[model samples]
Target: MTSAPLRWPDAADPVIRGDLTVAVAYVTPAGGAVVTSVSPLGLGERENGLVGFTTSLGFPKKLERILRNPDVALAYHTREHGFAASDSYVLAQGAASVDLRPSPERLAELMRASGPFLGEVKRGPLWDWLLREYHQERVFVDVELKRVAVWENLAARGAKAVTGAAWPHHPAEQEAPRNGTGPRVELAAVARQIHRLPHRLLAYRGADGLPVIVPVKVTSHDEAGLHLDLPAGLLPPGGRRAGFLAHGFQPQCVGLGMRTLTGWLTVTEKDAIYAPHTSKGLAAPPYRTLLTVSNGLLAKYGVWRAQRDGTSARLQALAARRPTD
Candidate 1:
């Protein structure tokens, strides 16, 4: 059967054409959801409703997983005030496969186009050596979409909104026509929504090498990592992996998008510092919205007797006073 076409605002196409970074998520052999960034130029929409992108053959982890299981998701969003908004995000659920052989010219193009988005790039001998290696190894990944979900706040403007189709849609997918006229939500606004709604799905790999998604509550936020108070039953039998998926959605904004964070998830017995190698020092803690600890999370987990009393002042005060690295 033919695939469904991905629809977006024609005007918004320029935003994607402009220099922007996109996030791609794939399942690990063990079943955990891993998310990482790629250059927007690599993503192209085909006439047959397929979205294609290029990656490094050297990046074997993602490639092997895609070969084994074709299910995947691609996401893009605009950052306003350094936070991602629920309404500003777009998610594509599709199947993926490798296409085209690795070529030096394509590798060079990727290296050149990606340099601007990278943080603190060093032009030293090591950097040049890595570039040489990358040119030797790169390949293309093609994703064919079955469904697309987006968030735009139309009700806020006194218009009726369309409900998005359920994810992993059936082959005979049916969805609302694209209007493409939604206000952009900044990253800060999305961060606020996530903070207010701390109930998130945490994805990880299990001991059997299958993926596992569990419901977790945010305990505290620190530079170290997210402190989660989860049911002991949810811990994976295998040791931790470098990738995790944290996702949440707002019921009030049905047509608006969902929020997802893909990064290394580390669990700690006591609230501790985020691992040194992880995160690569993007933003430090003591964050106002994104980095700030969520009292709602504390209340949900009943931290310090909060569940019984419905008050988290003690934990809230402690989180506010704690020093961040």
Candidate 2:
């Protein structure tokens, strides 16, 4: 509908200022997409001239992929335990630049930026030593917004304006199934896992080379694929590549778990089907100290791997004039 700067939820909207997390999709080297839930803590304009998110070295695979292909998508589809209370679903896709291994001053600012949404940062030697991987070794990924789409509801119906990139108009009917399209995971097992975490999202690359994520509900499953009830309407016909993510998290970033998959999709007028190909995820202990220590170990390993492979982004956070404590 519209182009350039997105203002549907409003820059000052609580969703932008203090959402616990958003689903991000990045392209894999193989051309498939993967989705995960991450905190864009204090998401707003950054050094890269676009809204951004900070991530820790604890997740090296994710960081490396972003460095390789800057194209990424961010979807704000939650109004849970956060400062926001809106029904809008915002998806922004653009090139991403990583500021890895930021200076202490920059890291502190990023932490302070997230203070309001996550509560005061836990410091002191005891807390810092335990949570160093999370609070210390970090990077910022700023997205150069190309296109942003906002829908009135999670179902993604009734676009506010059809600005920048042209979205796929629903064709006359669902396309015929493509070869190599079938169920990846056992329906019974998938249902068991998703049932634990109610929030479900599916992401597929849009026609413009960006990822489009939408809310989905599982209707049933069989040998073909995991059947999903589309929220509003399926933008593109099925028989395409997609990613699925189901997750659950608590406030303060204490504990979390998620299931992610890369799959083939088949869409019809009433529903869509996902045939997963690859799957990977993590489940952190719910306790703060435990989670912190676990991340500490992973970060230690990640930093080493990043160093060994020479994939670290040791860029300084260029918030030169942003005064910080």
Candidate 3:
């Protein structure tokens, strides 16, 4: 609901001061959104008023997407204790460029910015590997700050406030299914498929009111919700407002076929549970789950094209034979 300009290179910004890899989100060539992590080898505010970071030439999927569509978002997270934490994240709605062969001086600057996070690359196997395998191909991704949405204490403010950008926001409202509006026609079938897949990401409001994402292992997903096993410290004490996305991916000609459910999460006696909220592919209509499934299938075509033959089939088969599904 609010906008601001980014003030970079400040000693106070935890993103700059702390040594952590931020989750980066970007749109795929096929228009699907993908979230991944990147460790900045070098970072700082530039004279031109932009924040820059260095990453290896690895991850061709990300590199290709960045070159085609420069719009991107970055999230930084910190925890004071198991329960007290906040997300101080920034969204940069702008363009990014890749410099495949950065000059020696530039590479040094990037490495220095990364510091201890990049480890002591001065010598040892790490340095030797960098020189022999990766150094020559390293690239710098410089993001120009344009339209920005920054939440200093995201958990305290609530995730809803920062909902308008490329970052997938919470669904507005869940009304009863219209004649043909909600979920899929074979809700049971879809649910079976979803229950067979793995947990993708877990969500929780950080102490400051921002959404916190934790990758989790789901033991089960039944009428009650998702049963998960995660690190004890990852969750706050007691029930809290949270979300989860459990998804399976299949490759197609355009992008990917994704079966996913987004839901509210809470801690229970034996496991963390995710109660289905708004979903695509797996829920029954009047919710239009079919369209979500269709779109995801199309979007993943690009990603699947890069996979080996039968990979999609194997994943589909895996989803089909779950003991409870």
State, as a TM-score between 0 and 1, how close model 3 is to the true structure: 0.47
lDDT of 2 at 201: 90
lDDT, each prediction: 0.43, 0.72, 0.46
Q: For residues 1-325, what per-residue lDDT tens digits would candidate 1 score against the true structure? A: 9535655444324334442444566775533466554545535564455665666433445666666666666555433212233333444556676643557676666657554443222355754453443333345777766555444521111221222233321111112114321212333343354564333445443332333344456655544455555545335332243243332222211112235554344444443111112221122133222221231232224332442453334333333343341
Listing every candidate in turn, what is its Cα RMSD in Å to the true structure after a full C-alpha superposition? 19.4, 5.7, 15.4
Q: Quick one: best TM-score, which candidate?
A: 2
lDDT score of residue 130 within candidate 3: 32
Candidate 1 local distance difference test against the native: 0.43
Give each model a TM-score. Answer: 0.44, 0.84, 0.47
Mind giving the per-residue lDDT tens digits that candidate 3 earns over 22-107?
44555543223455445553264634545555554334556665665566645443321112233554443444656655798986
Summed backbone clashes in each candidate are 11, 5, 27
Instruction: Flag the better candidate by TM-score, 2 or 3.
Output: 2
Please list the residue runs of candidate 3 whose C-alpha ends up more than 4 Å from where it truly belongs after superposition. 1-12, 79-87, 122-130, 152-156, 159-325
